[model samples]
Target: MRKIVYLLFLGIWAVIGPLHAQTVKSDSVFLKLQQAFMAKSVGLLEPVLSNDFSVGVYNSPIAKYMLQNIVSHFAVDSMKLKAVERVSGKNSVLFIVYPHGEPAITTRAWLNDSHKLLYVDLFDQLCGLNRYKVSTLQATIPIEVKDGSIYLIATINDSQKPLRFLFDTGADGMAMRKSLADSLGLRVAREQNTSVVGGNMQIQVSTGNTIHFDKFAVNNQSVAIFEHVREGTAGIIGINLAYQYIVKVDFDKMIMQLYSMGNYNEEDKGGTTLSIKNGKGILELPLNLKVGQKEVTGNFIFDTGAGYYVIGFGDFVKRNELLSSGFKPYFSSTTVSMGVSSPTFTGNFEKMTVGAIDLRNVPGTLKKYREGDERATIEDGSFGVKTISRFNFTINLAEKTIHLTPNQRFNTPIDFMLGDKMFSFNERGQLAVLVDITAEQLFKQGDVVLSINDIESETLKKDPARILKLQAMPSGSKLSFKVLRDGQVVTISA
Candidate 1:
């Protein structure tokens, strides 16, 4: 019995000894981090940081150089480390820091197997204070409505020239073209593989940046770099802005207002307020769609990045047999995203309902999935800006609610394929016919349009608003198109 007890004691010590040593090392690293902050020196952190060390809010990791830049701007004269606590899993440690005249900050750190600092998550520490926070109670920014989308002007870093950004509710964070990032000399913090509308692609990200617009500024911003974006725009201002502020868009006044969270009252807004589901930065709402006599209900993303009314995923459309259930499709085209294009069909739904609002003769697009393709499970479809812009809506992401009031364009008829054909810009900026299902086959794919409705193609290309106006013409409206096909100019009337 004595021998057995001695052996058990040795076994216990064997396990405890390494754990205790790890704890001591972790504590030492934590202390060093605190010291680095106090001294405002990045060199002190170098000894403890891992080769792949990154620091940022939860799930938003920036490179070490970004943290160094941020630290260089810190005024930590009145800051002190309050406590250090060891968390349960993955050699995690929490640091409680107290700054003079500010709220206490709690930072979480993860140590690697070699006891080097792997990642330090400052989400709890900076989420409410400096990162993406607006100093004023409210800010009013002018908005431009073009091609059924909203555009706002902003300046990146220290650039003085105003850059137009699309206010996209579908994007997870801010995204800009790689050329723009290169022009601004933004440093690449990391690379990540991300899934987009059509497919997946690897993206480059920059962190710890600032964005300024009008009278407001956002600090510690993270921007994803893309290969290209829409013409005449810088990039995208994503849903992160809505997460930080109460976004109210007034289409009639052509303005967007950003109200501090919890500062705007819904009752005063006087609109139909409805709850929304926020999952992984995507906001969704339940929608009921009617096709012929069948009714299908599903949750759809509230996406301002989509320029059309609605886009149904393959899973939902196939499950509900939307194509065969007395539904009429007028034209077929291709939808492109991130340089990947997929075939699509467009038509009108009988009716669609969202909360208390009802829309009749709603237009929707459905993707044509290839065989053996994986179906989406997260969302049924997405509601686009064309339908959403009809309402002057206020979205409060903190409260998970949206207040919507109908605007003047509420009763406007939904736009459809004007002449039983679809058009898109080709590589050389020429308007080419994309789809034509007319009985006469007046237009063929790749036909370069020379003129439409007496408007020159070059003039139409210069002013896209003219194309939209032409496309929005009511049903039974006639149009004439002149195109170059088979090396010959041909005029067709519909």
Candidate 2:
């Protein structure tokens, strides 16, 4: 009996000993983290953080320089370890942090096999903690449509004056022009290189800023400042808003609705419901489209920031051999993002099936990847606002679903590309030739277009609707352009 009791005691000690040690180690790590925040130093965390330490659900590894920048400028007043648990078979701890002059944040940090800190997810926590529950239960804001994108009024921290912001589902988080940030005097916390549609550029991140959309406000948010944005808009509000609220965009009514996630009813919207894939920071949806007679099925990023109907990524286009395929090509154009432009060819698709709805004769663009272009590696492409605006859509990130109901423009014919020339508005709101594929080269690239078909550039700038009119001109129609080339105004006709 004594021998059996000794063996039993050894078994009990074996079970409890490691758990106690783990608790002690976790406490030590938490203490070091708190000290780091208190001192606004990353050095205190270096000893315990894993060599492969990353941030967010996307597992983006933080380099030493970026970590130092972020930690030194972190605005947390204090941090406390609230709880520890086993999450998805990994050791995880919860922390409650108070930002100076802002609400508290409850985030989770994960530990590696040796109990070293591996990852910290702060954006998800910020979205979860910020909830809106007013008497009306929803907020409706008016929107303006310009250049095939939706724009709305917003105000940055402590400012009552309104700024124009693009409602861009393509972007992961909030972004502003560097000029706007400089004017607002926002301090940069960290700087990182980011990939945009056309090319890559370095962007600065600013934290602890509040963005207000009428009465609805997002506090303690991070904003990416870019060197360039659309000409007339101050910044962009991305899909992060849907993570906190059920977002409904009504293009026909020119309004957007925001509802609390818990109080909203998906069934009431009455549209074809589709599941949304939670990507690194973007949202994706399955797309079944038909080009000519061939069926192409894949996932596409739902991008409200993009102006065209659809654009196939280089990988998707190359794998499917879409350029050589039998589809008829319309004209050559360029896709621009952050002031960088890439060559693309626009064509018509037989039909694009979105849930039960079938959109016929839709125009799509295919880009030919440049050598060493990083965007060529993406698996799929995006559906832009020109296509999305045909439907009244509701995005509920909490439920990972999107409800799309076709509106009055569901069957409207897409604007046919007029010729082998394409133009876009420059930063000064003047039209410039982006691409000219004609054999004669009637309009050269970088030519400032003064008038097209007697419509003045100033009029086109003021009335965006006229730009669409120019795009929809019937094929075989003769067109003339008054352009500023070199130092003299020249008239070109084709």
Candidate 3:
């Protein structure tokens, strides 16, 4: 699908189309901007996007000096515009750029009615829009699924220690947990605090002169290190890896394949292709979901980093009357997200359907969009790994399709249980129990849970990621936990 609004992470420039030429030379502006990007020269880029500029999702504007300092470290090449169309008004133009083998990028430029250059919205690609060079022939790497998230186990920097990263499309480049970064004593390049649409958080961006993934034996990769991640996962490996290789994620056999660019073929694909559009880094898919008897179709963000199966928007669900009248609510601890922290909670979906595939009593979580936050309104919902892992799904960003085939795991039931009440993290960094637990309690409101099923509480304090692993067990599965109540260790079985 075509879009005009853009993200700041990707590069951007404005060249007015013939749609409106009341003021300036359109061709000259485009040629200059295009030449500047190919040369990787900030001096040329500065004058084009000079004066006031802002990041895509947030309103925070940075001066040209700061933007110049940031782009000075980039290595860019093979840049060319693929498509452009005037939108919003004659002044706003949306263009698609094809950077050699990299994912196709969408950018937007706003101009004055007279067609004078205003500014462009660019997404943050640290390498400054370079295509990753394909190196290997064909390699199929084994993948593991835990708590509904796919993990790619790899050895970094030739170290014998294995690194686990959540296979994520929601991230720009890649991220390393600060704990691992400090433990490995990685050299830091730069750190910056960023303001996103939802809330404010700190992003510690790091660069490596040469870091090797001994398995793939890759080097000179740029990685970002964040302050926090879900427990049991070190960090995230963003979808940018697709730029260098043809990535195949098989949910059927629980494996992932990375084939060298020239080694991949069209015969390897089958089933219905899921259409996706990337205005920024997030891949949005067309989801025609059936909630109870009502069917609603909307575009859902493809978030492999998230664990839920299908998170419906509260307004959408309520309008469709998905839940039975006054269905009892069960609170679930799921998000570590800077956004959607205050989402209104509701009950689960008894059944759902994706294409011809029917899912029974599927486990899910619904998010009530936060007020005044544009990020929450970006999409109608999010389809996470939990729902996707049951199908053999292959994502081809180059072709812009997510292929899906129902696997043997498709009909398998999802066994999920949260106690009568629930626990989640509030803004104060304290646990919020949604229901009254003191009356008929297994655990109290303020009790710090030491562990769930022997997993430590260190990471659970940030999000309930570690505790969610046990949700896939059979209905008869037993749940055991250890908690700290009033400075004493207490064991309980549920």
| TM-score for each of the candidates | 0.61, 0.61, 0.54
- Scored against the true structure, residue 65 in model 3 reaches a CA lDDT of 40
Q: For candidate 2, what is the TM-score?
A: 0.61
Looking at candidate 3, the ten consecutive residues that score lowest on lDDT are 51-60
Model 1, CA-based lDDT: 0.74
- Kindly state the number of residue pairs that clash in model 3: 7
Give the better candidate number (2 or 3) by TM-score. 2
Q: Which tens-of-lDDT digit does each residue in 1-494 have in candidate 3? A: 13444533233433333333432444445555566656656567545452223322111133344345444533344344533445555454455555555676676555554444455544323323211333344667778776557788776664677888788866656777887978876777877664332345666776753333444554566677766665677777876666455577876576777755432344444566665665445677767665545566776777787656777655555555655534445664435553325454545566565555566555566654444444335556677777776667766554456677766655443433455544543223333343443355666666765666776644555444555665556666666668677888888777
Candidate 1 residues lying further than 4 Å off, grouped into runs, are: 1-136, 267-269, 371-377, 416-493
Q: lDDT for each of the candidates?
A: 0.74, 0.74, 0.57
lDDT of 1 by residue, 277-339 (tens): 664467788999987567899888888888778887766777787878787787777876655
lDDT of 2 at 285: 76
Pairs in steric clash, model 3: 8-122, 8-123, 8-124, 9-123, 9-124, 10-123, 10-124
Which scores greater on lDDT, model 1 or model 3?
1
